[model samples]
Target: GRRIRKGAKMTYTTTYHSPLGIITLASDGEYLTGLWFNDQKYFGSTLTHNSIDKELPIFIQTKAWLDIYFNGEIPTFLPPLRYNTTVFREMVWNILLTIPYGTVITYKDIAQEIAKQTGQKSMSAQAIGGAVGHNPISLIIPCHRVVGTSGSLTGYAGGLNRKNELLQREKVNMTNLFVPSKKNL
Candidate 1:
């Protein structure tokens, strides 16, 4: 176990060797705050304010969960998560948790769900994309499970290649899922 310091506060950190890439996990010594592919978009954005130690208990537990997950075994439960964000983003993350393992959902579908939950007439998929793209925690929260309405792999902060790798690992049927055309090829 690593000691924090004489007076410095504790910040937990650890790494997971995922099939897709190395993943960094961080916590406030309690709830997991972030998990991302080493170079994923918005990586570590949530824990930049604190110093880190790699031997925290939360980090150990998260690594264990990742171990089971990457072995193609469904994690019996989610690791503890804690984040500070807007209410809508929190709601989006909660909806993400409801997405079953090895299945995919569309951004439009998430938007519709949010709209239904909030009693709104409708919600914008673009708005949902913004929330999803900014998700600080990656795999544990299952952001990669979201796809585009036309079966396009729209956006994954961890890179599309890693997203595909994760889906394949989970045995998700990708028969119709395809990367979308950006401008040309």
Candidate 2:
């Protein structure tokens, strides 16, 4: 559900073999436009143009970032990213970047931050969840670090199993976090 810039017709894509699964990385020749698990929900949602299998400099940088990350270490650098989505989603994704490598935050926490930023009495946690679920750049933006209000591991677009794996990879304190029940999920 992202709007591609008019006349920006060409895009580039490359595949990353993550330990969990295959990930597809997309770029607009310079900035990273999207990264998603091959089988994940909303995969390639931001790539509305003709994408060729080309290796660009951004892809190389991103692969390095992911290389460090998949090695169970914090990546020392962030590859340049280009967001092609609504302003609200962009704001939510930026907040997600503030979540620490080995820590977790909740949808309610993000909503509160958005409220504080927008001068609103409150923002909807469900809305935040929606934005997080549709995040084009996944691991780098840290959408997998978000949990439910009750600390339940919920609503991961790349699958809850992958979310749990990522959190464990980061050595997060899993004592309190839990998978939600069927109805909750």
Candidate 3:
């Protein structure tokens, strides 16, 4: 969930018609605060302050970026993304950014990367999962590119179907990407 300090910041929001569905883009007039699929997990977390306007410059830039992305062509660069979160989540998000356009990584792999980055003997994949799962910015940060230890298309806050679609759009080979037969309770 997101926390908003009284009179300290203003969150602006807008909707974009994405190939997957309507996506809500939130910003604090400069840096992007959050992006969420319609009805997705944590859809409006911390979105307490808001002014709905489609013409916000950030929204326009983000839409253009997404247009290029959904068309199967990577944008020349990512739009400005500004989010405030804990250090561990920030590290996980940075690692997610390095996942490449069409490649996927396991939670275990991310945990190992975090360990290497933080100089720890070991890290927990589940801890990495907690960070990745709560990523405020989804596609731009490439959280959908993470999978399970077995290459299974596992938990995605944006839903597994959307995750699969995004991967296919990015040209990830789904032949090796399977789903767990049993759902996690």
Residue-wise C-alpha lDDT for candidate 3, range 23-132, written one tens digit per residue: 99988877787899978997867476546664687888998988999889988877788878899999999999888899999999999989998999999998999999
* Candidate 2, 1-185: lDDT as tens digits: 55778887788999999999999999888899999999999999978657799988899999999999999889988999998789999999999998989999999999999999999999999999999999999999999999987889998999989999999999999999998889865
Off by over 4 Å in 2: 1-6
Candidate with best TM-score: 2
Q: Residue-wise lDDT of candidate 1 within 32-100, one digit each (tens)?
A: 989989988888887655666567777888888888998899988777899889999999999998888
Q: Give the alpha-carbon lDDT of every model.
A: 0.87, 0.92, 0.87
Write down the TM-score for model 1. Answer: 0.91
Off by over 4 Å in 1: 1-10
RMSD each, Å: 3.2, 3.7, 3.9
Measured with C-alpha atoms, the lDDT of residue 41 in candidate 1 is 86
Residue 5 miss distance in model 3 (angstroms): 13
Candidate 2 residue pairs in clash (backbone atoms < 3 Å): none
Better of 1 and 3 by TM-score: 3
- Model 3 residue runs over 4 Å out of place are 1-7, 183-185
* Winner of 2 and 3 under TM-score: 2
